[model samples]
Target chain A: MKCGYSYDELTAYFDGELPREEQSKLRQHLGCCGECASALEELRFVRSAVLSAWQAEIQAPEDLRSNVLGRLREEGAFRESLPVKTPVATGKGWKGFKGWGAAAAASALLVAGASWAWLAGNVDNAPLNTALIENKPAITEHIPPDKEVKEVTEKEPDGTAGGSATDNQPGDKPGIKNQGTAVTSPEKPGTPRQTDNAPQQTATGAIALKDYTGKAFLSVDKKSYSGYFQLTDNWRNYDSLDQKIKLTAAGYNAALAGSFKDSGGVVTINVPTASYNALYEDLKGLLSAGGIVKGSDTTVESIESQYKVVQTELEKVREEYEASAGDMEKQNQLANRQNSLIDQMEDLEQRARISTIAIKL
Target chain B: MGDLKTDVLIERCRQGSEAAFSELIQIYQNRVYTICFQLTGNSEDAKDLAQETFIRLYGALPGFRGQSAFTTWLYRIIHNLWANELRKRKNKQTISLNAPIHTEEGEIDRTPADEKSNPEQLIEAGEERKLIWTAIDTLNQEQRTVLVLRELHGYSYEEIARGLGWSPGTVKSRLNRARLHLKEQLLKLGVKPDKESQKDADIRKKVKQL
Candidate 1:
């Protein structure tokens, strides 16, 4: 069938902007119409060429941040504005879920710097930084499984713990949750803490490959969420890395299990530790520089020992919580610690069973 | 930045927090610079435009009523600033798209290039990239702005219209013309999608479907 669709429609369709009914009709037409398909293919060539030319991960000059901030400082612009009570302060379900919120905030802050490094092409020991931050592989859109986690937090009578109340800043959506396990209180205005996620030392050699294993936490229904390594290599980006991971996983006779719920670019696959190195080497070729650090070196014995340490911490927090009289603040802090410890144990237990490599392209 | 986090930063900025403002700059500096660079096609101009955009953003924060996505608002500021710069240079050339070419069947907005005109030589991926940038360099201000907003930033037609303060029809037609013109220019430069890119495109399409 010959399609008479105009070039405008074709461009819109190629960009995935066509409306649903028109999109479906166009899709059917392209399936049967060689002329339209070839036209669409040509458009892809143009996009690819343009992207290749202009999209090679250009970083703002190192001093741009300092320069912008310096300019603002000179004008006293930052000093003139004050925090206003915004209408979007809808964090009811998130008030007491300090563990997830803090971890997410911490990881977000950490990844903000790490991704700048990734684009700047100067990530020194990126894998070690990744391990420390627990930043997911997908630099953008790495929100953890929130529906189940939020439900857990909602059951508690005291969900509004920590400094969230004092923070008083609005604009928190209850629905979207940030993913990561690191913790930090949300920074207040005027505080010098967490001012800059300074770019790491420049990467001079190939990216060291590390085991991109993630910490899995199964909810009450057996669904698991983990922190995946974000694929930030600008040239290959997400699509190329995704394809590479799939091919490597198949070659290793592994199950490309599934991705985390609600997160795009995160893929969870279970490759045997024996065949992991071959798979790792295959994937390493995809990286431009900065090798992945071997993050998942936890043995059965090491996990066992770590599990014991977390258990002891949990016990200590539990004792403190029980011993506390009527101080809500102290009790709240203890409760948060207890919850964090329990989550750690669950993470350890899951790691003991099988290693899950989540590639967030 | 996550929407919530960005909101927090905006709030802090309003609260006269220099640290919060600095963090905001850190998060968005690269992106803002990329937009500026794409429009100006040079690092120096891009740096100046980006710095100017933030300075304007800081001044305009009290008026940002959260009516639009922060990015949408920010990009709108960029477009306005760039348009103003082009006016100052007095070189803002709007491609004359009003003329239609008469074909045997009917009038078309643009003539389809003869497929046989494309060079058959297989371009190395690196070489292809250099040629692509050269082709991009040939685009005028309007075409380059539309292409950058659509392809690099992935803004939709409606969003582009709203950001650029044009009607949806204008954005759609301009973006389409920009794409076709870029393709035509690429072929003119003897650049075609090499085998590697073709394979990657196929793989990307399948992944998108999955």
Candidate 2:
């Protein structure tokens, strides 16, 4: 067996899904190999950090059980009767069940109506930060006032009832505590607090954050900087744009990293993650100056799993050698397997850290 | 149910016992709500989803042949519902991370109101925690779902695969993507944690301070 294993096996090993023999060998390789060890460490850290972050836990509303039970009662989804046959209510949060429910619903609808009126031009400027249930503090990035949302909001008819992007009540900036001249308020009223808050330390021992983007994306897939992007832009001003990006990088303390140019107006460069945003904008402006921009995507998961496969294969070889301790051929086979898998893992790890960009003229 | 009682409750629920069903809800409410809220990111929708999950479980309980653990089955239902709702909301373009999670204390911001109690170190920790969550919530649904199931719910790879109706390989890959995405978000947050392991409480306390 080759020392290399498939990425799936390595992932499974991390999840404790591998058989004992396979696990033992992978452990052996992991102990000997820095790349695999690092991969494992990263895997664990991401998982732990993410899950711990998930600790911004929220409990279901106290009335949830009743609401569901009432709905079931109304719909007759269950035949079993409850021990306590509490009165059923149709309104949300029991507020609606009372006669006041109508008034509350009307008020809510009114607010929704007014919000749509205000939201057309505003509602996402303050970086909406809502406290979660059970004291879990969660801050949502302000959704930038991009065209898609603006267009969508514009196309919708008036008094369309739904929650606005800024779910907080108007003028209630619940999360932000100003220590300086922070940009918390919208340029005008009725904007949702959805700006990306970047905090800076002030000279007066206070922390202030500025809201940058009008709104941020809701998912990683939609996020501007989330993927390994293959960006393509019309190189109409390829020369000047290239120079502009260099300047932009310098301005942002970002590196252009590396670039390859050809006569066909094709240029490829490694943009440091920090400076990629600025360069990307510059690319967009050049394209707008009369060109097109396109990008392809690659996921890091693919590379990590591939490394795991190599790690797993290597482990199998070590197991084979361990089972046949004194066999010279087997000992030699184990050594060969270890060498092969170690190299494979390092390659995958390197690929995981680097993002590739290919630009054409 | 603590241990053996869980099995008994399952039996009762399977037999159409409302008491047992209510018991199940009481016991697992936190777990169920946690998953639901994490997926939906809205307290209102989460409540509705949680109720719907239990109601569905009530109907599906009789078919529960004990092939898998009850929690797994319940979570499967939750995952299916949450995913479907996400797709529907996405299709309608109505989904927004903008919705504030409602709590008993009215709508509170994800950022704590007062961090004056927290010292500087604690504040840094809180900021890191917040950064992590913001990243996690921003994760694409597929990857986010796999991550919540594995990392937070402690589901085995095979179990998650079975629950999601995907191959175990798919589960691992999604988790990888989710983790890397998380790492990137954290990197952007300027939180370069030393390669040492930190306890969840420390993270939580720090976050609370924020």
Candidate 3:
């Protein structure tokens, strides 16, 4: 019942937290004591102002409720979109079919000999046989008898000494024998020389195989299906066998053109094969070693299969070259065409290298 | 009016009636929003907190035991949620409650209207409010809670003590300190102390009693 209270007691009294007896006493004191009473009054006024200010209503924007509802709906939809128990498959699985088709195409090229192979697969198949036959006669007619004679001797490395009768004591016209030999040479070219220097001589003629001993330059013109291969040696005056080997190294599969003396020991082989398979293999190996295989599979089989397909296509081009006119112009054209195909094949090989399989690598 | 019929409406909402929930919102939205606005000191936050309170109420309706008044339970939830939010923000090193409040759509609109009031009057009123709010903000978390319940929400001291799990004496002491702080703030705001003001307040109380 004190008239003069502490600041703490005054605060308690203002908040109505004083005990009943204390509250009555404080009220009685406030009725008489002006200072305590006024202090309590000012506190009440402050409380009122604070309460009113704090209780001031806030008007929410018109769009808030709708926006919240919309967000909730969107959240629901997003949750629903997540993949549940079932797995979803997209496009049809045509990968297997495409792979089979590629293999089949490669096989078909191999079945057809070089002459008809390129033309049959890529160009008109109908006129390919006729073109082959026409080029066949010209190749037979233009090839020198000496060149054939050298081939015959080269084929028989063991028969090189005693095969003089087949060459000199020829009673039958050499032309007829040459024609028969020419037709049969492709079927079985006597002993297929493993080494280009090994001489291959047929019964009708001596065709010495030249060795690619020196630096052999293999040039692939992908725009043209022809690759130019040349062998340069130190000796200028070489034998027919050396010349033939150099030409073969150039990828020349044609009947031998007579060996001509050039200034240097440079033996140029204008092999009219559509592409250089051995060079392709070397390049393919280099690419694979450099880690360039397309798709995910960089396996040996994948690289080899890709190279084989390219080789088959190149052989087809070579056949087309032989089946066409055997003139230098036709040969050059075929070489150019084959070079282009080879370029495309190389690009595809590169694509295959850097594809999904390469990613794994 | 008729015991506010809130319990009946809440029961209807529990029975999966959307209309009943909407009616409930209409009935208590203002009070809930006022409570949030008072706590947050911004309309946008108030609306957000209020809406959240109702949404939580709806979700927890099945579990509501109805041991207490619906509004009291809801106020408790809102207070707890706001306290948690404040604590979270504090932990994040962002304690500026007076930073311009943004609407849910990220628009700022908190400047009080001037209307016909003179600049001096407006500023005085604004400063007084700011001072009191700042003092409230300075209270210990529990003191602030007890003060808000007793003074702002007008809950009885016993109710506040029960709600906050504090003894009545603790609640009284905390409220006393809070009010003293508020009075000192008002004195700094230049509100003149007058004994006649207490008699006026007593007369208003007596008339209400009559």
Candidate 4:
């Protein structure tokens, strides 16, 4: 304290922060009092001296930048997804239900809607359809190869021949009730056999004839797409939803590509890129409004092309490494370039095969 | 640094664009490092704090809704992290002095370099400037923080209060106390202002001429 004023008052005066009247009084006191005057000057000198040394910019270490970027890249796929809360148009109906309950309800609706659509179709009597469903590539042992499809079709009226014969075959899984198999039946005019490999107009139109794990596809058979879908289902439904997702993927022959890692909400599955649009349409029917946080699509070709570009660069670097064998530094740089390219290629390869549909149930 | 560019970069970062985030680091790294250095008074810890700041920014990009300026949000992270570090240091202070310092590289010896005791480093700067830095280094965390923000960064009392989550009255008092503490430290360091204060030198010259 000085001149009957607290240090706060003097500091405020030094900063021009004292009220106009009090500032004038302090200024008057300072003229007669050397102590108050020097205190104010000392404040000014301290500020100037600190500013002089530190005003120059200080560069952060270069490795700090790399370490941050490297850590982010390392966490690339497993990073927590952004909380995207965009309302989905279809999810609006289940607005009352929360979390997994909403998802189960929506999926239940999908099962019923699919069953109704199948029962309404006249293709029920088609023998070739029976071959695709009852005698799936896995269950070929049950169907007699000599029986003509037309003859099998004609026996549908009797109900005794085809139904009774297949009933005793262990191939008839309990859920394979005609409704489950027929729900995924092709809706287009194409013959049922053609639905096995070709992309169809509807998500339910193409059915997986071969078990998902049976054959290694030689070509890029899937596109890459991701979605943030919310199901107002709660934690209690996690097990049931987990089982249903597996069954649903099996029903459609889509591979359950993702794990139930995060609170049982995120379910990732791989459908043939040909069936990508169809599966996307199928999910839109299951989620509620505000359920779809985001959806994005990218082509398998694009991912492959990116992989190819990285491969080409890797090859170029390899050639450089081979040519500069005597130079250790250049070789070290080439090795690092190769390692990063390999990492990128591996990531793209996995992405090309999996069309990630992140159903946040 | 323009609002439009920052917004674009922020949006890209939210969308998981590493390139844009790297660019943001480039733009603010120096400023962030400077603040960290000023607070910690050591290059190694400053680097660690700056790296931690960017990594936290990356994780938190999704939550940033542009409610405040990017720098303001960035400073808040630094402030919070520093507070945590201070708490951790306070806990460690209870340990024996001979306990090894656990750093990222490994455990280092506890024999910290005495910056003031070295005459060669002190002589590298003008005496007043050196004294100011030494005084700042000796001040408590709150005083140093308030002094650096209010004086060096030109932040208003209200801005400091809002950023630090203190009341305006608290900011006023803290800044006042910080200045006086700093003044006392400078005087203790034997900082004579005749050479430092241009006004005092000018007055002395006129008095001599008269």
Candidate 5:
């Protein structure tokens, strides 16, 4: 009776979903109401348009058929290579049997061998109990050099090593007494001297460094300390140290490895010892200013500085060594841990460097 | 099995006969390509989709049970592949709205030689066709597929339902809705409806209702 019909009824009218009685009623309504009539007309036009559009001419490219055939051939070849069920005729009837038993056996053997090797490798790398026992003393003695320095510098005159006021002590000038105590008292003269000559431990503990500075694979350039600080600061503010170190090591090795020729002659080498020290001083300044109060902040700055120095020196050695080493020998030594570390550092530095964007005024 | 020629070709193709496969492709290529083009609204996408359809069909041929017509099965495969491709490209932010006018060698010749048939009228009709196609592209994939199969390919409702794995009622309803949507679009394009068109529409509505 109403002009506006339910969607279901409209759909039925459109789709012939109505019964004969309803269809006649709908038609009677369409014949009378201009709006419903117009709606039905519009619906017809839309349907015809869709139908014509659906019938529009189309053709595949000339090469498409050939390409499809070629792909099919490739798939066929691959299928042929796989073990296939073949029909074999016997006195009874045709029976289906799979062939390539030998090939399957060979494949299984190879998989088994690879799995065994992987398991053996994992077992060999299992943390050695002996090494852990051996490392106990060294680990205890290895007071994180930074923490030791901080503990010594922050000590109070009462011999307590935490937060305490020097103003409480009679006859003590705040700045002078604090500085004197920080620089001299806690470290006995002999203790400082002994620490300076403490044996340089090799990274793997099997080798010893007669001269830690000289034997160091990585050394930051002291002269470039200011530049290194700026670079690292730029890196920290805009980029990540891990990413920079990774990228730098990657670029360095890629250049040194001759896989990439440096057009700008900027190999993006790591921060040298001097630069690292400068960064260290910057960190210390930050610490002194209370900017490095957070544990993460202090640890990140110190580690970043140390890693920069080590990475720079290592790259230099690698570049020099690469020049003298035979190509085959270098290839063979590609899996060496030392080389891997150098590569990792270069990669980090490269990533860090790229992340630094300059804004032009 | 009664159609020996087709049966032999199918058997040969199943047995890895390249020539047989090529022959089959040639025979069915246009229909399949047209179906793909209608579904995808682009020639390049249609070609790739058609090729993939054939590849899948060929791979699955060995397992095809003769429960349905071979062409029916092929249509089902093409439809499924096109559906997947549509889903894949759904996330792409950019889409060209203009329907491609066939300019290549085998384009449908719209030129009417009879002078009485006005060239202006033919041109108007062509433009109308283009608008209609553009509107068709707006339909959802299933609605579009059902409409195309019914109108362009002239597949029976049962065949379409079987191919698309929808109930007969679903096919009928979807086709009706799709047509109605298209009709509304055509009215927007300023096509005037007449009594004759209304009567034809009435008959179609009646057929669907049955």
Candidate 6:
């Protein structure tokens, strides 16, 4: 459009967009070059046309303001902040905001009760040989001379071995499939012999124990197995039931750990041997009230020597701490290490002493 | 500087004043509607986009710290939303509503002809306006956007560059090219020859002033 400059430059010049020197040059070019001047005129004319055509105001739809506000309302912006006062909230049903209030109140009352006898038989984390050594004096009275403790076998309500919700993990063998009938039925004959569990430690190395004649088999298992029960609720009222059972387990000196599954209605937990015997009746009655006890079955698992190794390591660390003779940092490390080993041993022993009861809803 | 009234309204809206937000929407609704309508060229689509802009603004208003004029922030929203909508159907066959709808694969006027008994009323519009709109449709999104912002909405070159996230040089060049391209299209339409003589006295007066 110009002598050497392009139309874009001419357009820029028309709009007063060029630098001062470029503007002066373009102004001089326009005064001399008719072609460049005409090109700038064309740019102005067309741009003015576009301006006129597009500048006319298009009226907005009348309801647009209300519609925007209405959409925000529809998105629940207004309702989200308000406490949802539905019938469930008002009635204090077990699943709503009001229900939570009621639950909190109930839990407060229960905590105030503090009924668990945790000190009477704090046996879950008793020292490794405490039971074998302390209870050995009583073992000869009831246990057979040759019979060793067998691992507890777990059975679901449907009479399936290890098929209960508690036994879902592989190789998690539990005791006594038909032991419900055996325990409930007092006349079931029994001959005391060593359990065919194929002891991991030989008879020489295993805890030398005078096996209690059938008296030690108070649980759903044949052996005086570890006191872990994986109790699950088949009933719909599992949350409260779970909380209640946990409180009951703690009240009676039991270590309970398991979440209540929503769908399958399963809860796995541990109750110490003493606590199990104490709460078994009350637990059965509580669950039976909810109609979940019928589907509940206990599976006791055999305790392995993992705890023994931890205890041995802990003892060695303690001896090292004593020999270090006030090497405070090394002693601190050894003390920390010793505490960690003791904790692991306690956790293992607790697991070993509890019965796993899986209740199927 | 931003509008003081709008700033006050924004402050109250951030403080959870619903009525203030509603006032803000009412104040700016026409500008938003016009921008969306000009871009979309359809009343129904424009209405939807205008309302949608306000709904988005309702959600975004709390975050507006007034870094720029509310109108600039508002325009950015319109531009982004319009660009996304254009990109969604950009690759598809564009609807030439005057053309037949049926084809092997192309954009069809889903708005059936029977819906509008007098569809030719659109053609009966000013030929210059029609030509201008057609030429605008031909531009890539950036050129058309910058051209519209500069020529129609009166945004400064710097403002458009900031809003579009382009350098000032890029905005200026694209706007120039858009005008040149529009001029070419206008020439091919043979509109200048027929009307230039009558309007020349007026356009020439405006041009000399420019």
Writing each residue's lDDT as its tens digit, candidate 6 over B66-137 gives 656677667777765565455434443355546433211222343432454543444344644554555555
Identify the runs in model 2 with alpha carbons over 4 angstroms from their true place: A1-10, A17-22, A55-57, A77-87, A91-361, B1-23, B65-68, B83-125, B194-210
What is the CAPRI rating of model 3's predicted complex?
Answer: incorrect
Model 3 bad stretches (over 4 Å): A1-4, A54-56, A60-361, B1-8, B65-67, B86-146, B165-174, B191-210
Q: State the lDDT of candidate 3 residue by residue for B57-114, as single tens digits.
A: 5544544555555655677767655654454333233345445443222333233232
- Give the per-residue lDDT digits (tens) of candidate 3, residues A1-361: 2555886778767667689999998888888888887777666765564454443344444443433322222111111111122222111111212343355333321110111111001122221222222212111111112332445434333321111211221121111111211221221234222222212332221122211212233322211112222221111111111132323333333432222222122233322112222222222232322222111110111233455666788899899898886588889878876875665454344322211111001
Q: Tens-digit lDDT track for model 2 on B138-206?
A: 577677788876766667887776565678777788887887787776555554545665664465454
- In candidate 1 the C-alpha lDDT for residue B62 amounts to 37
lDDT (tens digit, per residue) of candidate 6 on A1-361? 4288887677667666779999999898788898987877787666766664553456677777766654343222221111222211111211111222243334221100001111111223212122122211111111111112111112123121111222222222221222211111111144222232322222121111111111222222111122223332211121111133322321322333223333244344434322232233333333322323221112122223344566678889989999998789999888777765665554444433333233322
For all predicted structures, in order, the TM-scores are 0.42, 0.43, 0.39, 0.45, 0.41, 0.42
lDDT of 5 by residue, A121-238 (tens): 1223221121122211110011113432334324322222111121112221111111211111111222211112222222221211111122221222211111111122111111
- Candidate 3, residue B113: Cα displacement in angstroms equals 19
Error of 5 at A67 (Å): 1.4
Candidate 1: stretches off by over 4 Å? A1-3, A78-361, B1-8, B63-73, B83-125, B198-210
Give the alpha carbon lDDT tens digit for every residue of A274-304 in model 1. Answer: 2232333333332332223121211111144
lDDT of 4: 0.46
lDDT of 4 by residue, B39-94 (tens): 66557667767876786676555446565677877777776566545543432234
lDDT of 4 by residue, A206-323 (tens): 2232112223221111222222211211212211211223223213224333223222433433332223333433443333321331122211112333455777898998999999
Name the DockQ score for candidate 3: 0.05
Q: In every candidate, what fraction of the native interface contacts is reproduced?
A: 0.49, 0.40, 0.13, 0.37, 0.31, 0.36
In Å, residue A347's CA in model 5 sits off its true spot by 32
Off by over 4 Å in 6: A78-361, B1-5, B84-93, B97-131, B134-142, B156-158, B166-173, B193-210
